[model samples]
Every structure is written in C-alpha cells, then in structure tokens.
Target chain A: MNKYLERLYNGLIKENPTFVLMLGMCPTLAVTSSAINGLGMGLSTTVVLVFSNLLISAFRKVIPDGVRMPAFIVVVASLVTVVQFIMQAYTPSLSDSLGVYIPLIVVNCIILGRAESYASKNPVLPSIFDGLGMGLGFTVGLTLIGLFRELLGAGQIFGFQVLSLSWFTPITIFVMAPGAFLVLACLVAVMNIVRKKMDAKGKPLAAPTGCITGDCAGCGMSATCTGKRTADHTVKTE
Target chain B: MKELLLIAIGSAIVNNVVLSQFLGICPFLGVSKKTETAAGMGGAVVFVITIASFVTALIYKFILANEYLLRKGIDLTYLQTIVFILVIAALVQFVEMFLKKSMPSLYQSLGVYLPLITTNCAVLGVALTNVTKEYNILESVVNGLATAVGFLIAIVLMAGLREKIEYNDIPKPFQGTAIVLVTACLMSIAFMGFSGMI
Candidate 1:
C-alpha cells in the first residue's frame, strides 16, 4: 500500500478517532441528535481538520517547538472561522442547529492531537490524507450514530420516514440528550466485540498511542501517553 | 432575583453542561477516575470558567463588538473565534501564575488541571453562548458559574459510580470506557428528570 493510502486507512479504521481513540467526544455526542446535524458537524470538522493539517505540515519547520500547541490552535481556529463563515453563508438552517459547536471545534482534541502527533512530524501530502481519513472516520462514526438515533427517536432517517409511524411510536428518548450517550455506549460495545473477534483471528486492531486520556497534555504524546504519567513526565513548557 | 435563581437552577440542573449539553466530556471523562480528583477538577473548572465567562463577556461587550471596533464600516465579528481562544489561553496561564504565588495550597490542588482547562470546551462554549444569547456580563458570569457547577455535579457523580462499577464483574467487551459510558448513559437518564424542575 502507498504510504499516503496507509495514512488514510490508519485514520479511518485502525485508529478511528471517534471510536477507537475517543478524542472529540464533545462534538461526537452533542451534534449527533439527528442524522443531518451529525453529518453537517462531521463535514465541517473535516474541512477544518484537512486545511489545518495542510497548513501545519507545510509550516512544520518554522513553528518554534515550545509554542506548537498555540500555533496548532491558531491555525485550527483560523480554519474553523473560515468553515464557520462558509457554513453560515450557504447553510443557514444547519448553521442554526449546530450553533455554538462550530466555534467549539476550535478546542477539539482531534485537531490538536493530530497536529502534535502526526502532522507536525510528517510531510504535507500525507498529513492531508491523514486528516481526510480521520475526518471520514469521524463522519462515519457520527453519521451512523445519528441515523440510529434519528430512526429510533423520530421514526425517520434524515427526515424520511423509514419506520412506519403506526406500529413504531418513535422511541422519542433516542433523540434526546440521553439518547446520544446510550447510542454511543452501544456502538462502542459493538466495536469491542469486533475487536475481540478480530483478535481471535490473530489480527488485532492497532492500539492507539497518546491522547488516550483526552487531556491536552495527551496531545503531546509521541510514543507513550504523556498525560498518564503524573510524576515522571517532563512536559515542555512554553 | 427570581429570574437569576431560575437561570441558576436551569443551567445547573435542567441543562447540565456535561450530562445534557455535552460541553466538557473530555475532562469530565478524563479527570473522573477517583471521586477526590473529580472534585478537584470540578473546582478548577469552576474557577477558570467563571473568570473566563466574566472576562470574555466584557471583551465581547466592550472590545469585540463591531460598534466598538473602529466603528468605520469594519466588522471584526469574524475574529470572534480566534480572539476567544487566545483570551482563554492567556487567561489560564495568568490564573495559574497568580494562584501559585498568592495561594500555594489552592495552586497545589488545581495547578495540574489548570493547563488542561484551556482546551476544555466548556469555557469557550460558555463564552460563545453568552455572545449568541446576547447576555450581559452579569448573566454570563451566572450562567458560566452555573454550568461549571453542573459539570462538577455530573463528574463527581460519575466518579462515585465508576468506583462502585470498578469492583463489579463486568463482561469482557464492556470493560473500561464502554462500561463507564454505560454508567454515563444511566446517569444521563437520571438527569433528564431534572428538566421538569425549572
């Protein structure tokens, strides 16, 4: 496989950001109330992720080592603002539904985690692919959750009636706040089962390194989870 | 007075930052292993978010508002996200230094979590919420405090339950985060009842 393609595959499957790594739980759980909302949020995040990765990787040499976090943040924030404006200009309804989450993407751990651990070290093209792969993985994860919740909660999928209304009363709770948590739990449990099955076949899923704890400190992870090492870790202070 | 109380009650319980709104799940999940640590993190969040809310509100009202910026047909509203993130980063650093010098004991407990707070979405979320809702500084502070308190309540409760679940004989696939998430699901359901209170 081409190295670029490998990066894509890595993000989409082996180290799926949403499920396997669990990096951006805030957006993953929040905007997934409906299928369309989930898709919109995921695509918007993907745009930010791809462009930020490109810019960061392209400028990896010039960014001083000590201030990488803020640099990554500034780059990501600018990209998010661009995406925010585009979203507002083109898709007003989705913009209204997503609301504060667009700005909140600036703080998402996935973008920072990728910048610190991957893009900062890799070249521009591969970084872009990595971003695309991870973005698509996140999109798939969120969209599936949204579809399930929307189908159950509203007896429909993306506003189309999939389940007939007479028999299925639309498990309304599935679309509410609690529904997001429950759906995520079930999906994660299923992923665990698949991992176990794959493990039995002597082909185990790749265990993700760093950012496992979802802390900003974890974003600096290279080999081990720096945030998990309370006393031993010597982090670079800016 | 009644309105302020309602806002407090509404944000703190009816619309919890963690359980319902899902603003700070990263820290809510990460720092919630032990009950004691959870409480400490909650304290740090309350301090940072309350101050952030206050400061960001003032900036929005005074500095970032298009009326205040040049006032010559230049709308700087597009800079909101970038400005907010920078303000939060600088604010967290300043708070850490001030806490360390002025109150060593408080710093000792919250110092570790302070760096982590800069990336926590709840701080920025409250700020943006204040802006979108057009809240005055006072209302923003109250809402921010109430949201942080809500986060504290949810995280502490999650930690307590995780402690109990730690000893239980769980299924193989449901161990670790999956189980924790399941616990969160139930807690989320429990919190849903609070919606009727306000």
Candidate 2:
C-alpha cells in the first residue's frame, strides 16, 4: 500500500481514534444523539483537522520549538471558528443540535494529538492524509454509536421512523446522556472481541498509540491526557 | 437569589458537568481509577474553572464585547476562542508563579495540575458557555463552581465504584475501559433522576 492508503487504513482500523486511541471522549459521548449530528461533527472536525495539519506541516520550519503549541492553537482555533460559522450558516439545525460542542472543538485532543505527533514532523501531504484518515475514523465511530442510540432511543434512524411505533416504545433513556455511555461501551467491547478473534485467526491488530492499558506515564500525551493522574497513580514509577 | 439557586442546582445536578454535559471526560475516565486522584483532579478543576470563568467573563464583557469596539465595526468576539485559550494558558502560568511565591505548599499540590488543564476543553467550554448563556460575572462564577462540584461528585463516585469493580470477575472484552464506561452509563441514568428536581 502507498503512504496515503496506509495512513487511511491505520486510522480506520489499526488505531481508530474513537475505539483505540480514545482521544476525544467529550464530543464522542456528547453530540452523538443522532446520526446526522455525528456525521456533521465528524466532517467538520475532519475539515479543521486537515487544514490545521496542512498549515502546521507547511510552517514546521518557521514555528519556534518553545512556542509551537500556542502557534498550533492559533491555527486550529481559526480553522474551528471558520467551521463553526459555516455550520451555523449552512446547517443551522446541526449547529443547534451540536450546541456548544462546535466551539469546544478548539480543544479536541485528536487534532492536537495529530498535530503534535504527526504534522509537526512529517511532510505536508502525509500530514493531510493522516488528518483525513483520523477524521474519517472518528466519523465512522460516532455515526455507528449514533445509529444505535437513535435506533433504540427514538425508534428512528436519522429522524425516520424505522422501528414500528406500535410496539417499540423508544427506550427514551437511550436518547439521553446515559445511552451515549452505554452505546460506546458496548461498541468498544465488541471491538475488543473482534480483535481477540482476529488475533486468533493470525491477523494480529496493531496496538493503539496511546496507553489503553491505563499506563499514562508511558504515553506520549500523558500531561494533557490526564492532569497529574500519574502523580496519584500507585503503579507509576520515577 | 432564587434564580441563582436554580442556576446552581440546574448546572450541578440536572445538567451535570461530567455525567451529562460531557465536558472534562478525559480526566473523568483517566484519573477516576483511584478515588483520591479523582477527588484531587476534581478539586483542581473547580479551582481552575472558577478562576478561568471569572477572568474570561470579565474580558469578554469589558474588552472583547465592548460596545465601543462594536461601534467601531470591530467585532472581536470572533476571536473568543483564540483569546480565551491564550488567556487560560497565561493565567495558569501567572497562577503557578503567584502560588509558588506566596503559597508554596498550595503550589506543591496544585502545580502539577495547572499545566495539564491548559488545553482542557472544559475550561474553554465553560468560558464559551458563559457567553452563550449571556451570564454576568457573578452568574458565570456560580455556574462554574456548580459545574465543578458536579464533576467532583460524579468522578468521586466513579472512582469508588471502580475500586469495587476491580475485584469483580469481568468478562474478557469488558475488562478495562469498557466496564468503566458501563458503570458510567448506569451512573448517567441515576444522574438523570435529578432532572426533575429543578
């Protein structure tokens, strides 16, 4: 596979951001009440991620090492602001349904994580691909979760009534806050099962870049991932 | 006063920073393995969020959203995200320096947490939410405090539950974050019960 394809494959399957890296848990659980919300959030994030990655990679030579983070934030914040405005104008309903989350994308860990680990070092083309791949992976993960919740919660998929209203009393809670947590949990567990089976079939999966085993100290983004979480961790060492 | 009380209760219990609003979830899941750390993170979040919200609100009202600027056709409100983030970063640094000089012991405890939260979406989220809700400074601070308290309650409960969960014979796939999330799912449902209170 070429470099671009490899990046796509890696993001979609090998190290899926939602399932494996679990980078941006806040938005993942928040706006995924409907399939449309998830898709919009995902695509908007993709646009921001790709542009930021592209810009950062192009300016890699000029950004001072000491101030790279702030510089990256400015670029990303600008992109996110543009995306938010576009959503508000073009897709007013999605903008409303997504609510404050559209603005909160300024701090989504995946964009920053990709910038820090990929875009800052690699060439421009690859960084863009990396952003695209990661963004799409997150989109798929969110859409799947939203579909399940919408199907079960409102007896509808994308506001179209799928489950017959006569019998399927929309679980209601599934559309609320709890359902987000439950659906993501079940999806991840199923992914885990699939991984185990794939391993048994001699098609081993790649481990996620971040520590899924709860070892933040060893992870690259430990400080931002969890604030001094390692400080109070019993298993951590100097 | 009644309105303030309603806002406090609504933000803390009914809306719930962690369980419902879904801000600060990375720490909610990451630091929640131990009750002690969870509470520490919660406390730090409260401290940071209240101060950040207060400062951001003042800036937005007086500087960014000033009618003087608006009359000049200068709508700097679009710079809200970038400016707020810069302010948060600078504010954390300023606080760290002040704490180290005037309150070393406090710094020792909180210094470790300051940098970690500079990029935390909750800090910026609360700031933006204040503007979106058109909350005054006092109201913003109250909302921030209540939101932090909600986070504290939820994380502490999750940590306590996780400690008990460690001993259970969990299924293979539901071992780590999967089970923790399931626990969170149930907790979210319980939190939903508070919706009627307001």
CA lDDT, candidate 2, residue A39: 89
Instruction: Report lDDT (CA) for all predictions.
Output: 0.83, 0.83
| Model 2 spans > 4 angstroms off | A209-238
Per-residue lDDT over B57-80 for candidate 2, one digit per residue giving the tens place of the 0 to 100 score: 999999999999999999999889
Cα TM-score per model: 0.93, 0.93
| Top-DockQ structure, candidate number | 2
lDDT of 2 by residue, A65-180 (tens): 87888898899989989999999999998898898998888888788778887899999999999999999999998898888888989998888999999988999988889988
| Model 1: number of backbone collisions | 0
The residue ranges of model 1 lying beyond 4 angstroms of the native Cα positions read A208-238
lDDT of 1 by residue, B1-198 (tens): 787788789989998998889888877777788999999999999999999999998888777774746677667767889999989988988998899899999999888888778777899998898888887889989999999999999999999998898899998877776787778888889988988897
- Native contacts retained by model 1, as a fraction? 0.60
Clashing pairs in 1: none
